[model samples]
Target: MKFQKPDFNPRIMPPKLKVLTLEVEKFDNNFAGVCYKNGRRYVIDGAIPGDVVKAAAVESFNNITYCGLLAVVKPSEKRVRPKCRYYDSCGGCDFMAVGLKDELAFKTDYVRRRLFPFGTEVRDAATEKGFRNKITLAFEKTNGKLNVGFIDDKTKKVTDVSECLMHEAVFSDLVKALRFWIEDNDVSIYVPRFGTGTLRFAVARYLDGQLLLTVVGTKSLPSTEDLYKKLKKRFPKVGLFENVNAEKTNEAVVGDVKHLYGEKFIESEMLGIKFRLGPDSFFQTNAAVCGKIYEDALEIVRGKNPSVVYDMYSGIGITSALFSRVAKKVVSVEIVKKAARAQKELLSENGISNVEVIEGDTEEALKNVAVEKGGVFFVDPPRRGLSGATEEILRFEPKAVLYLSCNPDTLVKDVEKFVAAGYKAVSATPYNMFRATTHVEIMVLLEKIENDE
Candidate 1:
């Protein structure tokens, strides 16, 4: 039988396309729709909850499959028309098509599910539309023309977005002007493939009617001086900066920054506290929601009446300054030296003598802090969450820990570690800080249990 077998070519057969009708049950953390078929789960992008769609299996792994929505057989009741013209292509807003109420509910549910057995209270964003105070637009060369927009989700290509609904109207106006300037001047657009061109990213931050605009490129542009003049004339209260990043990396801001015009930093006030924001400073995008978060956190600290509060990963000491208003003494630990200097300046400007800024890593800075029994630790760690600092924080065995987190997964993990260390989770509150996006901010209050093994 083997000798008589005929030669066959596998390449002659076409791959079978598995298309199925899927009824989306809910949305996952990444805003992808979850559906079940044949006792296996499938995640389909571009499909909302309650959507009955025709989807094709794109890939399979283990017992799960990923799919692409081919057609919407039935749309969800929560679905609404997205405001932005580039919603289909732009990857900026994932829940733009869903109603605001539904979006908030989903975000709250998502956080609650991640932190199960912990009671959570959800708060909607103060401003649902035009809430973003900062916008960073990427530039790509397409057909010898400069396209400024976000990278597309499905194709991973740069999609030309003229306007974004989430950003302020001023942001769109600035983008229009920048696009015109690039086209009129025939400026070189950065193409990573060819390793040629100049401009890479345009970042605009709005605060207190002032705009801080940063033009990022590989090298200094020859027409920057002239362009700055034009831009200043157009936008009266604009601070222009040039950031040169020639390392061939994906970073937005890099080496050799020059303040071309206006002030070196933009001044903004949150909850009656003034903050000087530079090009690299970290500030929440939604000012009003951030104020709410700070108010809630301050309330938690006020209840404890801690003599000393340790603000870990304190950026520019805004929260630390706020803590100084309640706590007797506040110790702020930051990794960035420049930010620590800024924090010192801000504390002086605000006449806040209680907060002492320490420029070092949190894990090392904790060693020098005198951890009293009634002391409280307020940690606003990065998205990666607490690392070795978690152990250091527990070593203090403070009265309470107020942890603010942007990533719920890491937040839950850290909370579990705290629980294991004899700390009881008192309350977990989720805030809709980043609207229209799949991001949620959680503030958890943990108190040490007495006589725990």
Candidate 2:
């Protein structure tokens, strides 16, 4: 028996695949449909809830399976033709095939599920199309030719998108102009694998009839002056910047930046407050939806009339300026020095003297700030949500805490912490900030219990 061992190859015996028709129960936050078959659940991409699709099991993991849609046996009533020609290949929009009404409903329901038992009001974006104020396009080299656009979902290749439906018309014009400029100048595209080439990403921010364009590259190119001239000609009120990102990493933009032409920052107004945005400053993409969120947040803290308000993670002090209008004094904490400096300039230009900008880490800065009782804390953390400073901020025992989150999962986790710290989640509101995408923004108001301390 020991000498009779036979050689076998695992590749020769593949798992049997069965094509089955499954009805999608619901769609998750990522736009992947959840379908149940024979008492087991399967996740199918490109399938919407209420759709019956013929799919084959692609892979199995743990208790659930993943399948690839073969054909739509019965399409959902919510299904619609995607407006953008690139929607089929481009990975930017997942819900494009679904109707906008259905998309909003799914997002609202997703938020409700995450923050169960908390009353919520869902607000849709004013306009579903052309709402993005900023767009970042990636550059790639394929077959010794320059390619620029979004990455495809299935092929994992760069899809040459002449226009994106989510961005304004001017953005499309700029993209076309930039692509032409690159081709005419024979610009070298950055290839991260080999750590060679030049241009990496083209990021454009449009606001108040002006544009801020940041070209990220591995090194400075001699053609920047000409490229700037071409862009300025097309976009009269354009600010051109070259961001040198020499590292071999996946980050789109980082490291030293130099202003090539026009103003270093573009001025934009939100909620009657002026803001100076730089190429790297973080501003909400959907201005209309963002304004509504801010208005609601302001309303929540207006009644408190706190003597001092802490605007944590304040980017260029938009929220801080808004708080200054209500609170006697507002302190903004931001780790980015340039952003903090811009905030200071914005406040001074607007004659807003009540707000003070602190350029330092939020956690460290919170420790030094005077924790006055009855103060209001307005936190707008990143997608990962609150860091280790959650407990430290709670120690202040602020009169109220308003949390603005882009990821509901993380928001719910942090809300649990706030609840344990004797704060009650009074209201949670979801905003459809990013249309045709699975992402959503939520604002939660937490009030401290009177006798918790």
lDDT of 1: 0.81
Count of clashing residue pairs in every prediction = 0, 0
TM-score each candidate.
Answer: 0.92, 0.91
- Assess the local accuracy of residue 71 in candidate 2 as a C-alpha lDDT between 0 and 100: 78
Regions more than 4 Å wrong, model 1: 1-16, 118-130
Q: List lDDT for all candidates, in order.
A: 0.81, 0.81
Per-residue lDDT, model 1, residue 202, is: 82
Q: Residue 258 of candidate 1: its Cα lDDT?
A: 81
TM-score of 2: 0.91
